[model samples]
Target chain A: MIVTPWKVSGDVDYNRLIERFGTRPLIRGLLDRLGRHAGHLHLQLRRGIFFSHRDLDWWLDMYEAGQPVGLYTGRGPSGPVHLGHLLPWFFTKYLQDAFGAELYFQMTDDEKFLIHPDLSLDDTVGYTYENALDLIACGLDPEKTHIISDVNNIGHLYKLALRVAKRVTYSTIKAVFGLTDSDNIGIIWFPAIQAVPCFIQSAREGRNVAVLIPAAIDQDPYWRMTRDIAEKLGYYKPAQMHAKFLPGLGRGGKMSASMPETAIFTIDPPEAAAKKVMSAFTGGRPTVREQQELGGDPSICTIYAYYYYLFEEDDAKLAKLERDCRSGAIICGECKARLAEIIKRFLADFQRKREKARDLLDQFLLK
Target chain B: MIVTPWKVSGDVDYNRLIERFGTRPLIRGLLDRLGRHAGHLHLQLRRGIFFSHRDLDWWLDMYEAGQPVGLYTGRGPSGPVHLGHLLPWFFTKYLQDAFGAELYFQMTDDEKFLIHPDLSLDDTVGYTYENALDLIACGLDPEKTHIISDVNNIGHLYKLALRVAKRVTYSTIKAVFGLTDSDNIGIIWFPAIQAVPCFIQSAREGRNVAVLIPAAIDQDPYWRMTRDIAEKLGYYKPAQMHAKFLPGLGRGGKMSASMPETAIFTIDPPEAAAKKVMSAFTGGRPTVREQQELGGDPSICTIYAYYYYLFEEDDAKLAKLERDCRSGAIICGECKARLAEIIKRFLADFQRKREKARDLLDQFLLK
Candidate 1:
């Protein structure tokens, strides 16, 4: 299984990912401690969608002891936001509310421009503005949330990035990202820019403040590199809660915007998104006759995974749907039709909120 | 000869440097062309101290055709400003005055902080302020000159730097700078920062502006790299006029601030500076009896070179001094004592101007 911040393919083994990324799995005991500190557990945590962590317990411990902790997550604005991109952002919003934490939403517009051969700075920055609306739709409190665009907010970020760059050797960058002499210098220099928000709070406040990064496990390498030099630079190593990727509606792989049929983009018309869900891959028998006799497997069904990952918030209702699918009480066509309507409704609401978000965009941006 | 932006050693052959740097020699024809255009030649150009050119003809061609051209040069503010550091700045002032071009004086404080292992950001930034005073003391027109501190003006420069970085590969930087994977990421990223001012005017004016860089020949590599990408980025290729180095007071190398006795720093007390000139290495026979018959070698004299490089502006006076030294008519002690007074008087006046520069510093600074 391969996973990187830029690419993800093949069938990922979540258990193996924990070891490969060198992150601690969010075990039951830690989850209990987290639930107690947060007062109410986020759905992603309760369902183990956020499966791994780095120093997360310490962040919660700080919160328990009455110290303020911060939340940071980023989106690379190369294209339209899709459901797969929202996994961590949704969790981030939940944390902001539960922990009463200040939030920093970083838009990696520069990264998107440098990495995409055809993209101009204007294209990426345009996408940054488009993507920020979706982030606002995630229900993050505007009062505490600040969206930071790398290109626009670079005046403040560049200074902090320099401190990070000073300590990082090219060898470390090469080893961490598998970059070589042929790579463009912009990408080679970008990890330091990516590491900025990890220390931004402390840099601004003139005092130490704990920070937590909620992102996909694919991004753990960046945090690992940041952790190595964080304390040396007089800032706390940022804590992280790593979430699992939401599988595409296709048979396999993480949902990507490149394959429009396999992923539902936020900007896609609600009807178009609903059509995508109806044709999604599912683990069912070839015929209805065989499905009723042998029963279907919910474990490998993309439709079931979607509900478990995003749609079905009520645990009892979700479990009942899973059981009914496995017991053949729910057939593939009927289940898909229901899931499609659920998605359509969610998208319709999201699009409305996203439109309303434009009014609040300027206020939510970090100057 | 060994020369990189950070290091210069051995006896430099100025003629050989043209071929090595892939630049054309500033022949008599080009000098004549320049004199006619500017109405006169700067002292450095008149004496062949400004020895090489790259696209300087094209820049002048544009000027003759009534298109505006610009000027750029930089300082790595790692320490106190010394006489050797003034070579290019003085010539830059001449270009700004003669050509009536806007000048960009880049202070590479970020580069200094990153490259020097023991330096803090504060140290390099602090030195940037000290060095800016000396730049103003060079008599650059505050009305047309801009002092760009890399750290302070990074809001404008980093965007341009990123564009440079996008086109450059790590292999190119490694080959041009001899940087390796062992170097800090900040240093690996710095060539782009250094290349920014070459394109700054074009970026700021929202149109093409031909730029000229005046610098010691050791910094030719940066300009070569910048010239390679200039046309690709939609700006006129920056032209360069490379200058020969001023020798140290005591030894066989460029005047270096690290060796306090070998360089005359602007901040050095006038009497202490006079003492340094008194003990300066010079062309003289061991004894007065041997000196009369054998004479002396003015060609190898550090003291005579100093006068030729900075102190003596009159070509006739400089030639007469050189002839007297070679004829043993000018004794080393008598010549040094006289040169000491000239430097002492020059410094006393310079110190006054340097202090007055504080009043003009903010005006010269690029926000």
Candidate 2:
């Protein structure tokens, strides 16, 4: 598997990824302890979608002691928000509600413009506005959240970025991000800017506050590097819960925004989204008649993954649907149509809230 | 000879440096043309102290054609301002006054704090204020000057810094700056910040304006890199006039701020500065009686260099002083005492203006 902040390719093995990134397994015991305080585990934690972590139990201990824990996650607004981008954000919203934590949601427009040479600052900044609406549509509490646009709020971040950058060398950048001398200096300098939101509350409040970051495993490298310099800058090392990337509708790989054919965007019309869902790849069962005598493998189905990862919140219903697929009671066409209808309903509600969010955008911004 | 933005070492060979850095010599023809418009050349220009240049004639042509040519120069603000640091800024003031230009005087506090590991941000920022006072004391018109502190005014600069950073690769950074992988990422990122003032007018005014930078030659590498990307960013490539370093009191080299004994700081007391001049290294004669028969070499004297570089601005009187020293008519003690009084008088006036600058600091700031 190839996973850097910029790219994730190949068939990912979460267990192997846990070892490579040196994170602790998100075990049953930790989940049980977390649920005790939260009153219930988030669906991602219960289902082990968020499979690895670092310093999470310590953060929970601080949370349980009535110390405030801040949640920091970010979006690099290069394009329209996709389902893959929403996966961790939805879970982060859950973390916020469950723990009553404040959220610092960073919109890294500068990173997108720098990493992608063709994208202008105006383009990324435009996307920043569009994506902020989608984030608000995810049902995050606006009063408790601060949306930080890197360029717009740069004066607040650049000094701390300078301090963070001083502790990190180019060797660390090369080793962590898989960057080379061919990469732009902005990309090399970006890790420090990326680390800023983790300490934003601490810097503003003039005291240490526990921070918990929930992001895909690919972003764990940034937090690992941030953790190394945290104490040196007189801030606590941020804790993180890492999630597995949501597979694309095409096949079993991370859903990417760059490939519009592989993922559904939140901004897409409900009907268009339904069309994408219908054309999505699934487990191959040649001919319906041949499948009546044979069993289908639900394990390889993207349609089945949609039900398990998001759509079917009911565990028994998801299990019954999987059983029906294996017994030939459910065919690919019907299964796809069911997932399509569910997606249409979701986008219909989401898009309305998204438009309404435009009115509230200024209220949420930290600028 | 070695020169990077961070370090200057050995005896810098100006002619060899002109060839090495690929700049045009400031010959009599350019000076004669420049003097025509300004009515008279600045002492530094007339004496060839501002020795080498890049596109200076083109900038002057633009100025002659009724286009605004902005002046961009900076200080890193690591410590108190020294004579070596003042050499170029004094000439830059001449440029602004001569051509009726705006000045973007950048205080690179972020660069100082980032490159110097032991310096806290507070320390660099404090020095920024201190250095800004000295800059204002140089007789720059407050109405036409905008003082930019890199950390405080980052919102105005970081966007352009990001744009500049995107075009530059780490390979270019390594080759131009001699930065290693072990160097902090901040040092690698700072060239872009240092380059911003060159295009500040263009970025703010929504049209390209010519900019002329007057700096000592160590800073040429940054301007060269800026020139490479200026057209890409839709700004005119900045013109430059380079100056040679002022020799230290102890020996031949750039008068370093880190070595306080070798340099005279603007904040230094007039008496203390005079005392430093009295003990300064000069071309030696074993006995005064023998020096009448054997002429002393004024060419190797740092005291003589002070008169040539700054103190004795009268060209005729300076020529006579050099002639008398060569003829052994002027002894070293009387020469040192006279030069000491010149410095004492200069500082006594400078410190008063420096104090007055404190009240006007806010008017000059870009923020």
Candidate 3:
């Protein structure tokens, strides 16, 4: 129902969330406008998973006007990279290729350490490197992307973070994040670090540059705070495109690394991924006989949702699968087996790229 | 009067402050212990200017046992470096020379920017370089001293600041610094940056080393928080040597750059120093005849306190001046003129050294 930076529970209503967040829907006209510049729209955009935006049109206007525009997206490296983590990054890579924009990929290892008491800096940094491989495996150009870990590129971030931090009050953070006085000071301070990337390019280049962030809706709060202070700090407010979360393989809710069985990590081997997909919850009836009579609900089916989200990129094939599920032409067992094959094949290719990404790490790394 | 990191007002009682801060008085035995290693006691110790300490004996124990110890002190570069700012730094240099310890002189440019919204980062950074010249002019050995500014050396500080920030809570900082929710998040996060220099040497040296901070009593609150989490973070609780504030020329309390006419800066020329001293608050009676007839109260005099703190180092001469002022043997104008000469002489040497310090800036700067 509601999404914040830290929590994602209940079944989200995307249209209601769009109104609540005061963002514009990615209507067909806007997609056509973006397509004019991008040559072709990304599948996520075409499918409407990236369904809402704040100032995206303004960023596009700047791009069309021949002004510089940069891309920013980040990961909180508290654990292994999951498929959910890769969703927005792949879209970001698509934007980078289309616009030929410089991408600042921040790895928020410091935020993870501050938020999780049990996690050490070393643990978060280890996760950062592992997650970086997944990002590289997404095929973002190394020369075009700058991978920055908050702990590693702190020199670049800290000064800008201080500028942002100086403009924000404790009350503002408390209100935005619902933080209590008992929260660690790092938690209170970290939003500033996250906001730094939005203006870092302008700071480095000595000129105003528009920033576009492609991320899941959970990350919108950081941008909200960043937008509030952007003009005051002599930088443009960063534009954002919010993507709907990929649902968990469980009964409901978004996929999370914390729920190991409900989420598939990028690092998970083919066998492990298949095992997870095989055990996923579905929208079929209690009995196979009842399912044959009433038919399955593909709208609520996790297996079909996977196809809608990522696996089945071909629109015609995805539509047929959805129609067949609803018509009871395909059973849960057959659907599950087919989804497992696609995921295993995807993982096989991803694992190979992830391994090769290890050597290219330095090229993408921000010193 | 009470002194925390945020508040410093009223006439302070050194003994009461020592008790309130839960620190030990630097008694004769500890001075004797230090003298055995230092060869001779500095004037600050001899005259009881550096009067209070926290765990100084523990630091001494570490030093006596042949383990490394570091000296940390800092300046909030809000404006020009005045005599009050130099007092602790000079003593810190004394400690460095005596113990052969590394000195970390932090220029808190980010703190200045956060605390004063009207001031820009450029302004604070400008003051940082200016103040670094003053610190260098104090004759701190560049070979052993590392000068770091929060804005400039943030890369080195950010990771460590994050660790300290995680351990500290908003309530803790609020209580320590009298912070309210209205305060900027930067101010709330700043104590962590200040705390970093205390542990940076140990972090770099790959072994736990004792740290001793020399600063005015106002700065003790930061060390209190640092001490609280040092053991939890696997570092020694940094020791502190608190100095009495150098009185402003106009009246009681510390000399601050904010009150320009009251504080003689190291950059102030001879004429300006003379003008400030001539208008300074003194112990003498209303008129020359009244002062001759009735004695003065040197105890409450800012001019006399200045001499006691830095200018008059010789015990006999300082005692004679105090006795003469109380015995109606000296007039305010003549006393002011004499004090002005000493300050002018000190500033003359300081200015020359400051000019030379520009050439040696790189040697002391921690980039």
Candidate 4:
């Protein structure tokens, strides 16, 4: 929800990016009604920092040309998603509806099964279909989207993978992906497998079209490698828009699904959402007198950061909140309450969509 | 046609083999006049050198049980055939008609195209059809035998080759095939490709039956590799009848297609055949008088060697030639004349059949 500022080495300067990319006037205007779109597709201008991309103009060009581009997003389905996992899918769905881009949501169930010895074919199949429901619930177009379970769809891409394997070398793959001594052969091939979909989606039947990928910054390594291979294979490289990692309510590092308490889920009740925010990590000084004189550091405070990303999208409102928090004018408790209310409304609508997606699962599976 | 005695190190010991694996008098007498039974197929007894088989009993078992076991043979299609190539097809045809085994004869046109870089596809295709005529000319049953070119029939075996490649390792492949640094990847895979036909002829709807490959001993390595793979793949290893290599009428080595004068071709005119023999390499002493005085070494005399292999089918007659050859009583020139006469008679029937085959070239294409 928030553009979590990244540190290359030491200090995080959020103002530099505001100056570089600039703020969207339309996003500033739509602060209250965030998810609504004027056209068939809805584009949510992301404040989250997923990755720092090089070429964003090509995606804008495709959008301007009325070309049929698509939103390609996937999950490993290793486990139920944390709050961190929702960032890409939500952003992807926003772009899908906003630009009317066709969506391809791949459930990497086979990859999970290959990597996780404990996972069974039946178990992974069950998990992948269930996970598809969550992604669909996030508002991706059921008719326009292709939610692929890798094993079931292996036949479609088997020949292409072999062709890709022929062109790539072991040395190149290792260097690009940062593969270490313990990496499995399947993992080495997994990147190319992912790259295949990026190339394949751009073509209807072997003609190159344009594409855009919205994903977390960590996944940029795979796409970078994909960029190198695209021209070699006579396909276009997809432009990327990366959102920054959302920190857990516990603060510091990115939110992890493995530790459930630190991250909130859409399925979580209103009461639980309110309770989680109240106990969130804070940056206020201990003494009441000292805290009143010296305001909290909103940069270090997880609750204030959440408001900037999710609750308050207007630059003026965010600037006022940052000033009040730093000057000890607004307390952390009031900010927490505001975030809890915003999160509650978001979850209620998301949960309703989740229920509708479950009913439509059969329609997606039909031929 | 005479039994072409294929030599490894020296002359073939025909009399010794006649005592070793020859049919019993009663069996031989019954086979010589046995009428073709609709339910029971028979393997026609060819010449003496095309003897010493591994698993003919299983095929006989299948036939006795009223199951159809087809026959298969192939020509290399490198050039116009010498006398050595004739005996195999001659025997294959006799088996097809006499025993009613459905025969499939392959012309390795694709292999020739792969191996001979100077050859155009048109040249190889033209030569294969031409050689198919030669094979049919050798008296093979046109209705019973299905003759095919490698290029057309390659798809039948490609699936089997991929399956074989997955099971074999690079190290095992290198060791078995004598592959060196400069060999092409195509050459490395050539053995697996070759082994596919053995499996194809034996498989009916992917079930492995039995196959009998009648080739010279030098080709044993191919079968040995096939045998190892056959067991691994759960298919029956092709049973083989390893014949000895026929000596060239030139120097000490085997007859090569590159040397036009060393071997008697089916297309060779009578005068040319006679001249080739008269001037063929000899193991005789200084002069005709000395040859008569000192006796000839039949082991080193190409003229008498051809007689023992091809023209002299009468066991007692071959024995007399051998004895006369060793005693210096038989002149090399006199021996070549008798052999040439026999070869000329064989080519008369061959040319007539070949002429008929030429008329039905389209029939061989199966297009």
Model 4 misses residue A271 by how many Å?
4.4
Q: Model 2 - which docking category?
A: high
Task: Return the clash pairs for model 1, or none.
Answer: none
Q: Please state the error at residue B213 of candidate 2 in Å.
A: 0.6
Rank candidates by DockQ, best first: 2, 3, 1, 4
TM-score of the A-chain for all models:
0.98, 0.98, 0.98, 0.82
lDDT digits (tens) for residues B204-264 of candidate 1 = 8887888988888888889878888988888888999899988888868888988999899
TM-score of chain B of 2: 0.98
Q: How would you class the docking of model 1?
A: medium
Chain B TM-score of predicted candidate 1 relative to the true chain B? 0.98
> TM-scores, in order shown?
0.98, 0.98, 0.97, 0.51
* Model 4 clash number: 20
Worst 10 residues of 3 chain B by lDDT: B1-10
Q: Give per-candidate clash totals.
A: 0, 0, 1, 20
For model 1, the local distance difference test gives 0.88
**What does candidate 3's lDDT look like per residue over B99-213, in tens digits?**
9999988899998899886999999999999889999998999899999988988888888888999999999999888999999999999899899998999999889989999
Model 1 misplacement above 4 A: none
**How far off is residue A246 in model 3, in Å?**
0.6
List-wise, what DockQ does each model earn? 0.80, 0.93, 0.87, 0.05
Q: What is the C-alpha local distance difference test score of candidate 2?
A: 0.90
Candidate 4, residues B139-191: lDDT per residue as tens digits?
Answer: 66666666666555554554455445544544555555554434333344456
